[model samples]
Target: MSVRESTFPGVGALRQTGRLFALAASVVRLTFKRPFQKREFVEQFWFIASVTILPTALVSIPFGAVIALQVGSLTKQLGAQSFTGGASVLAVIQQASPLIVALLISGAGGSAICADIGSRTIREEMDAMEVMGVSPVQRLIVPRVLAAMLVAVLLNGLVSVVGVLGGYFFNVIMQGGTPGAYLASFSALAQLPDLYISELKALIFGFIAGVVAAYRGLNPGKGPKGVGDAVNQSVVITFLLLFFVNLVLTAIYLQIVPAKGS
Candidate 1:
């Protein structure tokens, strides 16, 4: 374990993890305090969505096609070709879609947020707010974090739809699979919880991205270069946290939710 004399003396990752959760809680608490920053939230939502949506859709198509192709090949080999659509689409919806959203949001939206806030922090705007009896977390960080969560949920649904379509197209056209069987299999195998978990993952990931970015922004190093470094660190840290959280959530979900026909 690494040690940082700044925050936690004995450990590095654990201390940062605690700090990140603390920041998240602050953001959540500020979310309920009014008058809410509707305009800031709207602006941030539009900005994040504008930057992430197109790239997400583009990435999802190829992502879905690849999963469909692989699953199709496997099922065909096992003489379970009729289950290809269900297996492939479910994989895309339940796993790949949220991961894609997390990646884009962290890489694009989260990085932008980190850079913007880090710049403001280094410029002493955060301190000025403190001196003026203003809460920077309430005024700035809260809206951005909330916006990321909302956008992520919406984008998760969009990615699931587009990804399922892409997967279907590939399975049916490229793999010479039957469209009817594909639809039927998916209908038979997919449950409402599959979608619920996917959107939940996106929401959680979005929150993680925003909180990590904001936290790093709040504590950047001593200069302009530090802001850039903070942005990179925020993205990397968010990615690692998202993946770990995803694994844990997926395990819990599988244990709690029974499979179809099981």
Candidate 2:
């Protein structure tokens, strides 16, 4: 491919990303305006949570189990088996919770949002609302964004709890780890700030996923294929942004939150 052809997609992606950010900012501004859609927000909250919670629980268990197995094996080899709980718990809270929550938000909630809005767009329902002076961003997008944030934070906590439990069970039962040591050292290496940072990460990821899905849905091209493409792109874009944002947040947290007992 020629240089121009290869670079075109990159340029287009940057432009689309800019538009996504602008749409997110618009939703945020609309959120503070009058006539808050409290009903819609509540409905969306329930919907997103219903779809996300079970999947998150299923994923969190295996996630913690695998981590515990790996950490336990290495710690045993080094005669530091007692630290397995602390290590596994910290890993779940600091890394797994946010990441898993983000993935579910993007995959489950984001796709649903994209498909819902995309259908509205394709049917010109959004345009009809616009003609009636109903701001779609305020009436629809803002509530979904807020719902995603709320569900994400709650899901992160759920994931953390389940992950810790899974780790405990695996380490103590399957791996022959001491139950007392696991429980005693569970929080030994974790600081309060770690929990705060993990929640913050989940909040940010949810907001990003919601906004991107809304943007893609709102701006879909003509035809059913366009809606499908928008949904696909929404998931892909959310995943990309989620990982990048997680990396940046992790770095910032490390700088701001000192290690436990430090």
Candidate 3:
């Protein structure tokens, strides 16, 4: 009788596990590092905001208008057209703002971050940093992750306010609802909890997206093909994870929060 010993069950499994742990450790340590470099953070912040803003604004404004139009038309048919304002406010604050921001960020900043790090990896820049006694995790990943989280929160807030206002203008001024009435409905519908949830979602999403993308990008195989594969994988994984997180958060919030007027 003879027995064959398996080589740890799979090819590269040990290396993959080690890298995974390294990435997790990087995230934890970076989170605790004090006196974070403001310059590095600001540079990443600028790049992310600039890359994401245009597409976000474009999508959100039109989404707001479409929501307004649909709700207005439906309510008009039911002789409750004024309620359109409320619907627009609720939709934008609770769902549209966060979702739209995530989409834009995933498309623009996510890919860019992944590509930047992947290119550096391919060029041995990360290795260079390691050789020079510099921690790439501290110098590169930390600042960008923190910046992405902050940017996501700020961008979502801006998107919520702008989208709601855009919807109001379209529904009230252009579509003939009274401005006073629309504002009143908007105020009633946009509760503090809704805005809080949206911002929280954005913060979580940004952190997850940044970290996941960074991990994939920084560990890609050696060369141009590897870089492209990393970028594509980053985008897909980020989007899927973002959606999954959104669902989980939504469920938790629904269960924990008291119902309106309850």
Q: All candidates' lDDT scores? A: 0.89, 0.88, 0.78
Q: How many residue pairs collide in each prediction? A: 0, 0, 0
Query: Tens-digit lDDT track for model 2 on 8-33?
Result: 13457677667667787788898899
Superposition error at 72 for model 2 (Å) = 0.7
**Tens digits of lDDT, candidate 3, 1-262:** 0011112223375665566456756776866876577898899999999988887878888888888877878888999876788878888877788878877787788788888988887787888888897777778888887878888898898888788878888888678888877877766655678788999999888887788677777866657777778778778878887888888998898798764555
Residue-level lDDT for 192 in candidate 1 = 93
Indicate the worst ten consecutive residues by lDDT in candidate 2: 1-10
Tens-digit per-residue lDDT, 15-102, candidate 1: 7777777788888887999889999999999999999999999999999999999999999999999999899888998899999998
**Native-referenced Cα lDDT, model 3:** 0.78
Superposed model 1: Cα runs more than 4 Å off: 1-11
Candidate 1: pairs in clash = none
Q: List ranges where model 3 is wrong by over 4 Å.
A: 1-25, 173-175
| Model 1 lDDT at residue 138 | 89
Model 3 weakest lDDT span, ten residues long: 1-10
Model 3 residue pairs with clashes: none
The order by descending lDDT is 1, 2, 3
